[model samples]
Each structure stands twice: as C-alpha cells, then as structure tokens.
Target chain A: MLLTLGIIGILYVGILVLLALRARTDVKSSNSYLLGGSNLGAVIGFFTFAATLFSTFTLLGMPDFFRVHGIGAWIFLMISDAVMVFGLIWIGYELRKKARKTNYLGMSGFLELNYKSRFAGIVAFIGVFIFLLPYIAIQIRGVAIFLHATFPEALPMWAWAAAIVAVMIIYSEIGGLKAIMYSDVLQGILLLVAIWIVGYNCLHHFGGVTAMFEEVEKVNSALLSVPGPKGLFDFQFLLGSMIAIVLLPYTQPQVSTRIVILKDIKSLHKMAIGIGFFAILVILPTAFMGMYGAVLYPDASTSEFLNMTFISDQSNLIGAIVMIGLIAAAISTSDSQLFALGGELRSILKGDDEKMVFLARIGIAVFAISSLIFALLTSDELVLLARTSFAGTSLLAPMIFTGIFYKNAPNLTVIPMVTLVALIIFVASLLNFIPNHFLGIRMDLTLLAIMTLFALVCIYTDRSKRGGAIEN
Target chain B: MTNERIWTLCKIAVVILIILTFTPLVTPSGIHKPAFMGLPYTLWVGILEAFLLVGITWLATIVHSGRHEE
Candidate 1:
C-alpha cells in the first residue's frame, strides 16, 4: 500500500509542477486565461476534449453500471458516445465558427446575439448555473466516495473535496485554461493507461471475451436487456440518453474553447473523430470492467458497486491505481470546467460590466462549495442523476432545434413555448403528476414532440420576416 | 468565393451545426436532466459556441477587408 501510494504521490507532485510550469508562460488576461487566447492547437485540443469527457463518471460510475447490469451496460454507453460523435460534429464545428465571428465568449452571449434578446442571454445564464452546479456535485461525490470507501477513517469528504477544489482553484487562478489543458493532457494519458490495465485485468478475470459474454448470459437475463436493470429501455432512458449526450457537455464554455482551438475545419473533423475514438476506447474498457464486476460481485448496490465489487483488495497498489485514474478524471474535467465556469462568469455576471480575476476566482470557490453541498445533500447515485440531467436537456431540445428544421421563429411565440416546456418539465419532476410515458411514448419524447410543435409553429408563423429573428 | 459568399456560407454552416447538435436523430426519452456536473446543459453547450464564432468572425474579417480594399 505504501509503495503504490508513493508512486502515485511522486507522480502527482512531479507532473503537477511540470503542468504548472507550462501554464506559467503567456498567463495574462481573462481571454487567454479563459479561452487560451483562441490559440489552443491540435494536441492540446485533443487531450482537453478527452479530459473534459473523463469526469468522475468514467473512473467510478461506469464500473457501478457494469456491476449492476452486465456487458450490455457498457454497450449502451459506448453506443451513446458513438451516436454523440455525429452530434458533436454537427453542433460543435459550426458553433465554434459562429461564436468566433460574433465574439461570443459564452453560451449566453451566443443566444443574445442570435435571438437579439438579452432575455435569452439571461435565461441561458440561469440555465448554465443550474446545470453546472450539479455536474460539479457529482465530482465532489466521487471524491467523497473515494475517500470514504478507501480509508478506514478518511478525512471528511468535504475537507478532501475542499482541498481538491483548492488545488484546482490555485491553478485556474494562475494559468486559466493553460493550466487546465496541460494538466488535462497529463491526466488524459494517465486515464488511458489505467483504463487499459483495469480492462485487461477484468477481461483476464472473466477468462476472456467469449467466456465473459457467456457468463453474462448465465447471469440475470436483464443484463442483456437494452436498458439494463432500471428500465434503462423504458422510453425515458433511451430518449433521455440521446438528449443528454447532445445537451450536456456540448454547451460548456471549455468545450467552446476547443472549437476555437481548432486550427481549421479539417482539424475540427480530426479532433472529433480522434476524441470519439479515444473516448470509446477508454470508456469501452471501463464499462466492460463493470460487466466483469457484475460477473464477479453479482448483486451489489449501485453506489458501492465499483470499489466493493471491482477491487478485491484494498492494498495500496490497487487503491493507488484507481486513485490515479480517479484524480486524473476529476482534475482533467474540473480544470476545464473551472475555465469554462470563468467564461460564463464573464458572460452572465460581468459581460462588459466588470473584469476582475479575483472575482472570478472567488466565483470558482463558490462553485466548488456549492457542488460539495449538493453532492452531500442528494441521495441519488451517479446513474440516477445522469438520467435526471438528461431529461432536463431533452426538455430544451425543441427550442434550439427550430434553427435546424425551419428558418424562422417568432419571439412572441417562442418565448412562451420555451417557457411552457420548462414549466411542464419543472412541474413533471416536482409533482410526478403524470406517468413518464404517455400514449405508449416516453414523457420526455412527448415533451420533445411538444417542443418541436411549438418551435415549428413559431418558425412557420414568423418565417416571412426576412431575417426577422433568431432563426436561420 | 466572393467575400459576401464566404460570409453567407459561414453563417449557413454555423446555423446548421447548432441545430444539428441540439436536435437528435431519434426521439428522446422522457428523462429530464436537471443538471450535469452541477450546471445546466446550456452552460455546457457554451463550449461549442466558439465554433460558430470562429467561422462567422473569419467571414466578417474577410468582408471587412474587402470593404477596405474597395
């Protein structure tokens, strides 16, 4: 245990210094700090994108999914990411270009520009805060989970989270995105290697792929189901996964930075495919490891499944290995998220209203604290939260989709329709007044349908104005 | 392409991308995501906002340069 911890500790201190030093150069202004001066190149872009994708989910929650279900759980995630490839190409590539032209630094800024309504910007700002806080909460939960399970007497998860949050804050303070991408590159590499080891071990344990699948079949037939145990096949899970894939990380400020980071359209294509392949390869193993856990541990609770089931021994070596990957995933994502959080800070709170690095740093701290609170407060495990977040975004789909399906939308109509969708979702979540599925359709699907109808009518009714509004 | 054509194409491409990202190929599941990582998905979507930006801004730069030449 000591030996493994020593190795991981040495790695942490050594590489972190190098990462810090890299960011030391050209560290100035929120622009360069937040977006890397629109100068992030191919290598950094790829890793940052990959790192951004890591999050705690990759390191921890995926194994939980596997232990709960089987090989099929992994297939769902891999397929979702695969499907996400197209969505990223379609959404990310062009949005990067438009944002550059408009000088839109944040999502709110883009909507403001497109809709020609400051209200859209305000709505965006509020929406961003709502989504980002919970995403951060999960990271905190992973940290807590790690400390809680690994150590007989761990530091309070809050203290550990605060310390972890503090380190991220310090670097983000000094380097902005430069710190993030550099660290991300390092974290990205660690995650990939660790994933390989874990995957190899799991496959070995399972006696190989053929035997593994057979065992999975032998186990609960539900593991073979499309959605896995929790009715993942229920209309809600399928459609929710679709909406979540596109809706979640795609909108983040750090993600937007990658758009500008691309050298050209050709590079954008490469980054997309590269990141997609990497995400698949990396997540593929982790998810499969989950299946291995399902085979090994069988019936285990979702939260404790990864460590309780996957890791047989709590000795330092295994702990160090998992910790390294977990930290890599956490730091890589949190750092990027920190930078993106800064971008939104300027957009919603500052936006030509103010520019204070100190203020942004303070905001970062607040964000971390809030995330810690939310994680501790919420009882939902990783997958439940993942599904819930997906539902939230699917609700917003039609409002934005109108730009694709039609060329016009009337604000008078759109404003109310978007309001209606959000209101309905808020009500649905709070009241559970209706079944998740309506008329043999998932409620989320129903919501999307309604969203589409409203968007279409708005566009159709407002189309003739000739560049009259936020539509194509 | 003329400067105007470039701007037009750039604008069109960007618009198409945004629509594509937010809209799904298949219908959605009723599951609602209250937040990701802790923020709304819209906040996360800001990352791609840069892509739309670069294309259109480049087009504008080109157009502005043409006007200067004119």
Candidate 2:
C-alpha cells in the first residue's frame, strides 16, 4: 500500500507540476497571477470552488463524524452546503458587480478601497490570517496523521506535513492561481470518483443500504435520530453550522477569490448550482462509509475506524487511490488558501507590482511554515476546529457585507471591535475558558447573532441620522 | 425584473430555504419516522429541499438575464 501510494503521489505531483509549467508564462503581472486574469469559466470555476470547499475533512473527518455521531451529520453538512450554494448566487452577483467597478485584487484590498480606510484592510487581513491559519493546518494535520497511522514506521508526522507543504508551494509559485484552479479540476474529479467507489464497497459489505442502516439501528437506535448517540447534533449546533458554512465563501479568501475570478454572472450562476449538486453527491457517500463504521467498528476510535475502513479493508490499488485522493484533497485546499494569503498580502502592500508579488510569495512561505508548526503542535477535532475558523472569520462578514452592499460606511471602530470580540469568544471556547454550547445554543451562533445585531443597529442609527439631516 | 426586485426575491427565497432547514417542519425528528429508499425521511426531505434551492436559483438567474436582454 505504501509503495503504491508513494508512486501515485509522485505521478500526481508530476502532472500538477507540468500543468503549472504550462501556466507559468501566463503570469506576467501580479494581478494576473493573483486573480487568474479573471478568465475562469464555468467548468474550472465550479470545480475549483468545490475542491476548495470540500477537503480531507470530507474524506476523513466527515465519515468519522457520522460514525461517532449519527445521521444528523448529513443535515449538518448538506443543508449548510446547499444554502452556501444559493448564497453564492446572490453574494457572488453583488460581489462581482462591485469588483467590475474597481481594481479588486483581494477581499482586504476591496474593503480598504471601498471604505476609504486603511485600518479596515488591516483588520480584515488580521482576522483572516488568524482564523485561516489553523484551518489550513487542519488540512495539513489531517493528512499527516492519516499517513503516520498508515505507515507507523515510515516517517514522522512533521515530515509528512513538510512534504505536502513543499509540493503546495512549488506548484503554486510556478503557476499561480491558474495552476491551482486547473489542478483543482483534477483533484475534484478524483475525490468524487474515489469516494463513491469506497462508499459502494462499504455498502456492499453489509447487505445493502437498508440492511446497513438496520444494523446500525439495532446496535444503537440513536444513530438514526437527531442529536445522535453522542448528542452532538442538537438543533442549535446545526443552526450555527448552517450559518458558518453559508457564510464560508464570503469569509474564506480562497472560495471568495474563485467567486470573483469567474468570467461572468452566467458562469457564476451555473457554478453555484453545479456546486450544490456536487455537495450532495460527495457528502452522501461519506454517510455510507460512516454507517459501515457504525455497524462494524462501533467501539473503535476515530483513527482506528478510519484505518480499518479506508485502508485495512481495501485492496492495494483501491487503498492507493484513496490515499492519493486524500493527499489531493489536502493540497487542493491548502494551496488555494495559502495562495489567497499571498494575494491578501499583495493587496495590502504599497510598492511596485513586481516587488509586491515578490513580498507576497515570501508572506505565503511564512504562512505555510506557521501552518506546518501548528499542524505539528495541535491535532484537535477536525470539524470543530474548522467551525471555529468559520465563526472567527464570519465576524468580518458584516464588515465585508456592508462594504459591498451599502453606499455609506459605518463607524470604522465597529470593524475591529467586532473582530476582536469574536476571536476572543472563539478562542475562549476552544480553551474551555467558555462553554462551547451556552444554554443549549452554540457559542459561535450566539456570537454571530450578537455581531449581526450590532451591525444592524449601527447601520440603522447612521441611516436615521442621515435621513433626518436630509429632511431638515 | 430589475436588479433590486430580483435580488429582493432571491433573498426571500434563500431565507425560506434556511428556515425550512432549521425548523422542525423538515427535520428528521418530524419526518424520519419511517425509512424510504434506504434513507431516513429527513434525508429525503433535505435532498428535496436542496433540489428546490437549485431550482429557484436557476429560475432567478434566468429571470435576471432575460430582463437584461430585454
């Protein structure tokens, strides 16, 4: 299995490198490099968006989530994803309309440009860097831990992480966003194909889908209901999850950058619906694998269940495909995000285009190294860590939302205050300084509600004052 | 449809979908009493809801572009 996986990983990286080499000549300017020259069409746009949104979390974290929790896991992911797709249509249209009127390179630059406030971009960049770094590390660590478990004697966890980061940086530097998008197309296809094959095999192992669920129900009836066996999927938990996931494209730089790079509104619309379907297709299979785990390895730990189901049970070729797919998932997401961080830096830098691009690459290396260190240090729950990143960044949602939709800006003080408070609350929850769920409501949901209400009140007050002045 | 009208309707549709997802009206607790086609009823409803979302968004896009051409 290790030999097959190693050969496949090398071949996959080689294909990506060749693709990057072909795209290198296209990167004549920093704008072109960061934004893909704004030439992405429906096919590439849809796949890149899908690839970036669903990653190792889908392959590893999600099935484990389902096995440990229950069926509510489906609603937690699919519903949120469906809503996110619809959101892209409305948000994407407005964002693109705004982008066309300015030299929009990244979200931070857009915020700074539109609000006419340097601090706005600074706060935006800080919030993204803080929240997204761990999210990137989640991808890195997820794959590293899996590889370590698969080959206990092969190499250390950090070595696996460094290798993945090296691959991501080399390809990203060579081809820029263009190479990433093209590679995303390949990664997305491989992910969908590999997941379905494993899913079917798992289903066939038991009698069928019906028999599998029956077996799960017989073992633990909680697996079939809301707030499953562990009671992890309560109403409030699902609500908070929906909000975080729906706001993902707006808050996450990688997905949002893809939103702006599409060629036109028509492509964006097609891509949005296509992504919605892809979400359902990709997620349903994970549920199947989870059911397999629930009935067969009910008492096994997360890594144990994953290893048994995804690796030990499969033949050599299938195991290699799954491993490569996992690696592809990690790289597809990590590179998009790391590149977006570079784009964010480029957006804020005040220098010549060449110098700005050069600095941005350096910034990317810094971000990747930081993520590697975090991956080595922290290996928390994947889905929960990802949720924290989402909630933290969603605090900046109001800032960006107002920047795009409203003609008049609110008090600049509100942006940083909201961001600071949101991050503090999330970090506190992570450290157990505050409860994750307060009185049955998730803390992140409560935080988002408070932030949105604050933004609304400020907007209403400012608008009323302007209205009174106009009347007078 | 003008941009304002189209965007307002899109927002309304999205809000409705969200409410459906969160409310017990479409939840498995409400719907998953029986298994159908190898899935709990809640999953079936969720799938249907997703398709409805795709349908509405597609229609909105068409309306927006149709108005543009007009």
Candidate 3:
C-alpha cells in the first residue's frame, strides 16, 4: 500500500509540476483562463474531450456493468459514444460558427447573449450546477470507495474523497482550464495504457480473449449474451441513454468548452473522429476485464469483484499502477467538472476579469467541498448515478439546440419556462414523486420528447409572428 | 465534390446512423441467433456501425476540408 501510494504520489506531483510549468501566469484576460484562448490543437483537443467524457466510470463502472449486465452494456455506452462522436462533427461546426458570431464565453453566457436575457444564462447555470455537482461527486466517490475497499487500513473514504477534491481544486486553480486539458492528455494516455495492461493480464490468465469468453459461457451462458443475467439494458433504457450521451457535449460545459476551444473546424472534425476510435479502444478492453470477472468471481459483489480483479490478481507493482490509473481517471474527470462549474459561475457574474477570476476560484473551492459532501452522502452506484446526471442535464438539450440552430426562438421566457417545468417533472420522477418510467419509456425520454415538442412550437410561433409583423 | 454536396451527404450519413440505432440493427434480437466472425451478430453490427461512422466522418472531413482551400 505504501509503495502504491508512493508511486501515485510521485506521478501526481510530476503531473502538477508539468502543469505548473505549462501554466500561463501571463493570462491577462478571463478568456485565456476560461477557454484556453481557444487555441487547442487536434491532439490535445481530442484527448481533453475523450478524458472529460470518460472517467473512473470507464475503468470501474464499465467493467462492472459489463460483468453484471452484458453486451447490452456495449450498446449502452460504446454505440452511444460512437453516435455522439458522429454528431459532434456537425454540431462542432455549427457551435463554433455560432460562438464566433456571439463572442461565446461559456454555455450559460452563450445562451444569455443569444436569447438576450440574463435569465436564460442563469437557468442554464443552475441546471448545470444541479446536475454536475452530483456527477462530480460520483467520480470522487468512485475512487474513494475503490481505494477504501482495496486498502481498508489506509484511509477513510472521506479522506480519499477530500484528498482528490483538494488536489483537483488546487491544480485547476494554478493552471486553470489549460492545466486541466494538459493533464487530460496525460490521463487519457495513462487510462488507455493501464486498462490494456490489466486487460491483457486478465486475458492471459484465462489463456486468451476467446478462451475467457468461452469460460464465461460455460459458467453462465447468460453472461455472454445481451442483458446478461439482469435485464437492465432494455430498448428504452439504451435509447434514452444514447440521446443523453449524444447531447452530452452540448449540455456538459466541460465537454462543450473543449469543443469550442479547438483551433479550427477541421481540428474539431479530426477530434471527433479520434474520439470515436478512443471510445472503441477504451471500451473494448473493459469487456475483457468483465469476462474475466464473470468467469472468476461471478457471484462477488461489485466492490469485491473490482478489488480482486484490480488489486489482488495482479503483481504488486501492476496493481499499484492500475490503482493510480484509477485515481488519475477520477481526478482528471473531477477537476474538469469542478473547473467547468467555476467557468459557469464566471459566466453568470458581472464583474471584471480580476474579480470574476477571484470569485470563480472561490466558487471552485465551494463547489468542490459540496461535491465532497455529496460523495460522502451518496450511495456507490457509479454508472446509474452518472446516467441520472446525464439524463438530468439532457433536459437542457432543447434549450441549447434551439439557441444553436434558431435565429429567433419564441419568447426567450418560454424556453426557460419549458425547461424549468421539464426539470420539475424529471426531478419529481427522480425523487419518486412520479415513476421513472411510464409505459415502458423512461421519464427522461418522455420529458425530452415533451420539451422538444414545446421548443418546436415556440420556434414555429416565433416564425409566424415575424411573418405577420412583416406583412403589416 | 462541392462543399454543399459533401455536407449534405454528411447530414444524410448522420440521419442514417441515428436511424440505425433506433432500428433493430442494434437490438439483440436482430443479430442474436447468428455468430458471424466469432462474435454475437448484435455485437459485431454495433462495432461495424461505429467503424462506419468513423469512416464516414473521415471521408466527410477529407471532402469538406478539401474544399476549404478553394
């Protein structure tokens, strides 16, 4: 445990030092700090986007999901991610075009300027904060739980959570978004390498990939098929999940910000394609790991399965490195989210650069602390928690889509009203005031459909009203 | 090809991808009974779909970006 912690400590400090050196203390404007001066290249852009989209979820949640659920887990995440990457090509082009037109600062600020209403921005900011805080907490808590399960004597869960949040907050403060993006490049590479290394080891233990799956089939044929032993991955669930993920870059500011920061449309295009490949490569190995778990520890609990597979099954050095990789994945994602929340706050503030930066830093600390609190409070269902976050933020999708595609939307007030109502309905469902699925459809999909129809009505109403005024 | 034509094709490609996901092409029942390439039909189809999207995106980039110099 000490050796593991020592190695991770060295890597963490090394990354911080690299970022500190890369940090532009000369960032004289909020633009430089917030958007990295919109100068990210295709490589960094792709890595940052990929890293932000994946996290400890890919490392921890996915293997367990594949183990518990089945191939449907692949359809749930891999296919959805693929669709999202394809969508990004066009959306990135259009969003960048609009950003150039609107002098975009942040997601909320973009909405505010386009709608010509501060209320729109505030609603967007609130939506992000409400959804993202829990999501960030999940990432922090995921690693905390894993580490706690692995080393019961090392540290308490809250300490692990706080340590990550503190490191994220401090690193994000020093290097800002640029630092986060740089670290993402490192994290992305490490995640890919670490997963494959561990996956290879797991596969080797069972002879090979096919041999592993064959063993899984022998143990439980259901494990090798769709929906696995559990029917969690049904049509509606996968469909709703795909929509949420496809809308992710638009709704998640950390991801959307990366989209906007690419140097050019072509760069964004390349980044999108690269991410599709990354999704495939990163997710394929988790299936191997999952198959290994299915054969070795079919009846084990999620934590036990994870602890045994990641820690006990490997050499001490490899296990320690893999653990650090898990930590890296969690912190990489948490920092981007924490920093993006700060960016959202910066967008809503009306102060000068210095004042806004100061306040945003303070906001980062506050939000991190809040997320740490949530990490302590929430249960350890990482994938479902993440899905809820995705579904929640996706309620903002119609608002953002309208702002992106339409020149004139109905009363700016109407969209936010629709958004707020949909949010209420969704939250009620989440809180069990209402059922989460109705007639085999997820509440989120139902709300998204209703909200989209409302948006269409607003657009048509605005168009007709304009036509009538012109006739007059 | 003209930039407009390329973008139009790209849009169509995206629509097709969306339709594919919604269709039984991705459903387990669609490819569950057969094993082509030593994997479940649904699984390979999903993988192929992802590859096709990436392929399309790459081609679209080449086509659309080619005209950027014009």
Error of 1 at A446 (Å): 3.1
After superposition, the stretches of candidate 1 with alpha carbons farther than 4 Å from their true spots are A25-27, A309-315, A349-358, A400-413, A416-424, A427-443, A465-472, B1-70
Candidate 3: tens digits of C-alpha lDDT, residues A254-347: 9888887787777887898899899999998898888788888889998899999998898887887888888889988998888888888888
Query: Candidates' lDDT values, in order?
Result: 0.60, 0.82, 0.82
> TM-score of model 2, chain A?
0.96
Clashing pairs in 3: none
- Indicate the residue-level lDDT of A83 in model 3: 75
Q: Give the top-scoring candidate (DockQ).
A: 2
iRMS per model in Å: 13.8, 3.2, 3.3
Candidate 2: clashing pairs of residues: none
What is the lDDT, from 0 to 100, of the residue A26 in candidate 3? 61
What digit string (tens of lDDT, one per residue) describes model 2 on residues A1-472?
Answer: 7688878878987888888987786444776788888878999999999999999888888898888887788889988888788777666677777776788778988888866777888888988998899889999999998888888898988899999999898888888888899899999998998899899999999868788877887888787777787777777888878888888888888988888888877788889889988988999999999989998999987778888888899998898999899999999999999999988888877878987888898898899999999888976478877877887888788888876666666344565567667778777887899898777767777777777777777767877867511110
Q: Show the lowest summed lDDT stretch of 10 residues, model 2 chain A.
A: A463-472
Cα deviation of B62, candidate 1, in Å? 25
Q: How accurate is candidate 3 locally (lDDT)?
A: 0.82
Candidate rank order under lDDT: 2, 3, 1
